[model samples]
Target: MEVKNKVIWITGASSGIGKSLALLAGQKGARLILSGRNTARLIEVQNALPNPECAHILPMDLGDIESLQECVRQALGFFDGIDILVNNAGISQRSLIADTHMEVYERLIQVNYLGTVALSKALLPHFTEAQSGHFVVVTSLMGKFGSPWRSGYCGAKHALHGFFDVLRMEHQKDNIAVTLVCPGFVNTDVARNALTGDGSAQTRQDQATARGMDPGRFAQKMLRAIEKRKMEVYIGGKEVSGVYMKRFFPRLLHKLVLRSKVV
Candidate 1:
């Protein structure tokens, strides 16, 4: 569970929480493999780390499911083996199910659910061979609950929890651990880049996200969860209750979320 000196692969490391985790993990003496679509931005993150040797950038589109196995192979070539796989690369949705096109849901599933699962499956053999590995999935609070306008996003994240939870049960003997991280809104470009009904970026930031938790602080909390090898960790400021509310007080929470003006 000790992160220091462990090899960690973090997807979506160009910015936001993934970037923050990369920097913090690098400072903590962990070997970091940062992956994302933006080579330039990933390199910038790599440079900002305290120890350059602690981190390297792997630039690729995780949404390209067909190439994920090759990506895993490429990663194995760089280091001895991957001790942790942080599945964080994902897109968000802002359109209602009625107004959304089929493709919007497909894209969300492809990038968030299918892509993560494929990459994790591709790396399963490595974890089994080594008899130890961690799968740290960055799901959303929406995964635990549902939002009115974010049906697709919510569904995809929900699927992730189910998949990883089962993977944990099935791979326990192999010493493989699966951690599902459910974070609420964080201050990041995620909202601005969220997809609309037409498969276009929302381009507008949500008021809630603009005033959400600091990405660095969120990453710090997430790192602690990973170190503990937690089964699941849900973190947020006030919005953390969204998970509990949905579980214990579904009616009140559902009505409140539907009526909330923030979204």
Candidate 2:
């Protein structure tokens, strides 16, 4: 559907892909409710929008699952209604399973999977009543295939696919759409912000991630997929081929990932 005049709520809007999506969607004339943990950064994004008046800042921590229902309530109040909810707030992993702490896994699951599910569930009745809404999930290619140094990240992302796929099946009658946008790798602070062995931020960029697709370019592709209401779309460079390789040539994909400099 055309995004012009649509009310779009985007999570993790402070920077990276979410920030790009918010800016582009605003430029397209979509009203926005930008949510993130950083209030200052969220305000910065708001001011950067083409029509700042059309955008609202709602700072939230996705990892705090209990607050999401209230957060959704506040978000809906911003625009009276929401046409799309983009689940883009998530963390990445950059540690081996053997060294990673269980707390790290829990944090990843809380923010990346359960938090998204809870927020979506809280907004379900609204979408049901409207009989029209879209759920844009920014999952990762890791959700589809495994890679070294990202076991927890992979697990959490994979769970999102399972949950959202079922959600689509159950909510189709409500005229609700689900679009799972799987990004292979994008030039973002994801690596730098990734959780390491003890649940601390890695604070360093990965070589592969440094050369990934631009966040703006990736956002453009993602918005197109959302407009088309695609069930799923993978965005990235050559790493995108890994999805097919994992499906048609699992052994080869496994070998390739093992050989690659994942970090």
Candidate 1: which stretches are off by over 4 Å?
none
Tens digit per residue, CA lDDT, model 1, 1-263 = 67889999999999999999998999898999999999999999999998877787788787899999999998987777899999999999888778899999999999999999999999999999999999999999998988888999999999999899999999999999999999888999998999999999999889999989999999999999999999999888888888888889999998988788656
Best by TM-score: 2
Cα lDDT for residue 163, candidate 2: 98
Across residues 93-209, which tens digit of lDDT does each residue of candidate 2 receive?
999999998999999999999999999999999999999999999999999999999999999999999999999999999999999999987999999999999999999999999
Question: All candidates' TM-scores?
Answer: 0.98, 0.99
Candidate 1 RMSD computed on C-alpha atoms after optimal superposition onto the true structure = 0.9
lDDT of every model, 2 decimals: 0.91, 0.95
TM-score of 1: 0.98
